[model samples]
Target chain A: MNELPMSHHKHNDPLPETVLRVKALESLLVEKGLVDPAALDALIDTYETKVGPRNGARVVARAWADPAYRERLLSDASAAIAELGFSGRQGEDMVVLENTPQVHNMVVCTLCSCYPWPVLGLPPVWYKSAPYRARAVAEPRAVLEEFGCSLPEDVEVRVWDSTAEVRYLVLPMRPRGTDALNQAQLAELVTRDSMIGTALPRSP
Target chain B: MNGAHDLGGMHGFGAISPEPDEPVFHADWERRAFAITLAMGAYGRWNLDMSRYARERMEPAEYLRTSYYEHWIHGLQLLLIEQGLLSAAEIEARMQRIAAETDAGAES
Candidate 1:
């Protein structure tokens, strides 16, 4: 494996290129004055702001509020998440991996970028990088440590290699000092890094 | 199972044919894809519903066949084209025009 120049994880699929060509076509239209750039701009803008991390945060909050819901989220994440009105999309076979002192779970799409979109939203850049993917599985502790997270020696690290059938989301142990917080306040703690088990949720 | 980006057993238990020299990504494309969609989302222009839609609705093979950035690029184009920001013919014409302009510029 070390002898090979390219890591297998590189996105070698032809479809994304096809997708780009279509965009090229669209941009070509923009240059021709046939399409409206403002509308195009607006649509892209909406995804960046309205679509990230919030859905996952909501699920985390709900899990904290209701035990039964949390149970369902653990057992049948797809159905449970849909209850909060955040299901479907790319990762439908979503699995919520709860983090505890006894065990910790991290996710990587070694082939490309597999993420629990139905919950965690899109993965962060660092999550999909070559260094993170290659290292997370081989030396999970070191990787977590780099992200400023340290687990007791007793806890076992279980890195989830995302497959086509099942997707994963880390249900991080809710950060302390948040017991008195409301839904909105709790949601703020669910950063993309924490959800992947790399960083702990920050109270601030 | 397989998706757009599956590289056989390249990642694991089995061995597969190797790729020719290592692939290096162009940073600007990732930045543009992330920045533009995010800027648009932040501005309240559109939601990432399309990525979700594609992730769920599109056939798994198509999903696997696309790169991470390619998926966004596809989603972005669909969002733009669907919204009528550009017509099919206009884009085709523009590609030709850009090619011509580039060719002419090269001559000078």
Candidate 2:
């Protein structure tokens, strides 16, 4: 069984433009003579060392290697991801939406920055802002094109609106030539954007 | 709180700036940051574990409000504060001190 941790939710309400709120809180702390800059920096450094992208790569690599697992992943993402010991913490509930020829899928947290962190790691620089949330649903193809990804007109684009409690990840079609590759080699193609459905796996 | 920068499909506003001169964040950084954000949460016990937390934890409005990098940045900040590494006032004092030092150094 996966070790499910607890989260501190229940205070959302559009979050008051998170950046502004954080900045406000930070400034308030600074003004109040509360926070120590050096300590904060050091703490950030510690977390930086402890956290990394390897886990995200692992999820992608695993999906690439096992077909049975892949089917399982598509059916029950939370359990499939956990099979590799990648579950819990920031990631609780998960759903994997595959990109098929008939229908294209894109993931977005229109309300807030909900994402599949276990598989893809963190959200990219653009994935957590107003512009992207509003635009992705409005113009997914054009947005994807900006990321150097474009689907043919024949493919229908379906956007996934991730909400509270349910996070989503994109299981891009595995590239061809990768059949001969090992897990590590396969991981190289699982870019952060690819797992989020912004980019595609490299042409194998 | 959900990390801010996981906006996968929220690009509909579609390149506010003109394409040629639009701001371009490095793809590698995004990958690195995402990885870090997820890992930190994994370590912090903020959710049911790494996989479950990352795959879940989507709040509708807040998720859209935060930029992708902001999510990592926010998560890290939250962790720092939560861990008691630096209090609110201490950080400000350091910022002021640094600014003063920089100003003095530049003048001299």
Candidate 3:
């Protein structure tokens, strides 16, 4: 899903202090020959387009369409995800949790920004914000509600605290009346927030 | 060092305002910062753990004051200088030049 334009700042304004610091560092790094500009561009390109939520969406869609795949995903998420060639740093040990009628799952890394980078690309600014890190664990239900996800009283909410040793991904339930849809179409309904357990997959 | 960056379950930081259509980077320099950090990391001179530690090791006030990518550039600068890739003097001089350029732009 394309991100809606963030209204945090006025476009075409002067860059922030952090931006200047970053620019200085990049210039220094290149001037010193510590980093190759071309290599940097290639790396940026990979995360910007080639990898990200789309990769994770495909995995979720595949699991939703195939029961065997769902079983494998739950039993050994790392291997199952690697099946789709989405395995690398921060994702070396991933555990996929299935959302069900009785169970809801959410993921948060309390310590720093330990995330499944290969599958999720870089984490969003909100995900890295001080407010999110502090509130996600203390008041997970309220946090979910803020994200527009309200669970029934009968459903149990499980918040997975991600660590450097292991990262977690939430496999959102397939929407109703999607039985007719193929895996590719199912992926179209799967947004990044769904896998993060902040929001549910779009209804068809 | 369990610093401000380890912000899980703490309070008073306020609500997360997600920009409706936030680009991956807010500024051109932010994109470059992301790329440079990744590029330096790719060289294998230091592990991700070290970078995290470096950022956490930053002064609490400074760490809290700086932006997310700012922590990255700070840590990257420290690591590169420590590894002898660049001298501290060179970084400081370049920063001074940048400040001067900004001042000149303001005057013009």
* Model 3: colliding residue pairs: A3-B21, A4-B20, A4-B21, A5-B21, A6-B19, A6-B21, A6-B22, A134-B9
Tell how far residue A30 is off in model 3, in angstroms: 1.9
Clashes of 1: 21
Query: lDDT order of candidates, best first?
Result: 3, 1, 2
Model 2 C-alpha lDDT per residue in residues A109-193, reported as the tens digit of each score = 7755667656655454356545566678878897788788888999888888887578877777778777788988888877667
Which structure among the candidates has the greatest TM-score? Answer: 3
DockQ, all candidates in order: 0.14, 0.14, 0.48
TM-score list, all predictions: 0.61, 0.58, 0.89
User: Which one wins by DockQ: 2 or 3?
Assistant: 3
* Candidate achieving higher TM-score, 1 or 3: 3
Q: How do the residues A88-145 of candidate 1 rate in per-residue lDDT, one tens digit apiece?
A: 6566788889988788887776755677766665565455545565566667787787
lDDT of each: 0.63, 0.59, 0.80
- lDDT string for model 3 (A20-137, tens) is 5676778887887878988988877887778888899999999999999999999999999999999987799999988999999988877676778877777887777666677888
List candidate 2 segments past 4 Å from native.
Answer: A1-53, B1-108
* Residue runs of model 3 more than 4 Å from their true location after superposition: A1-17, B99-108
Clashes counted in candidate 2 amount to 73
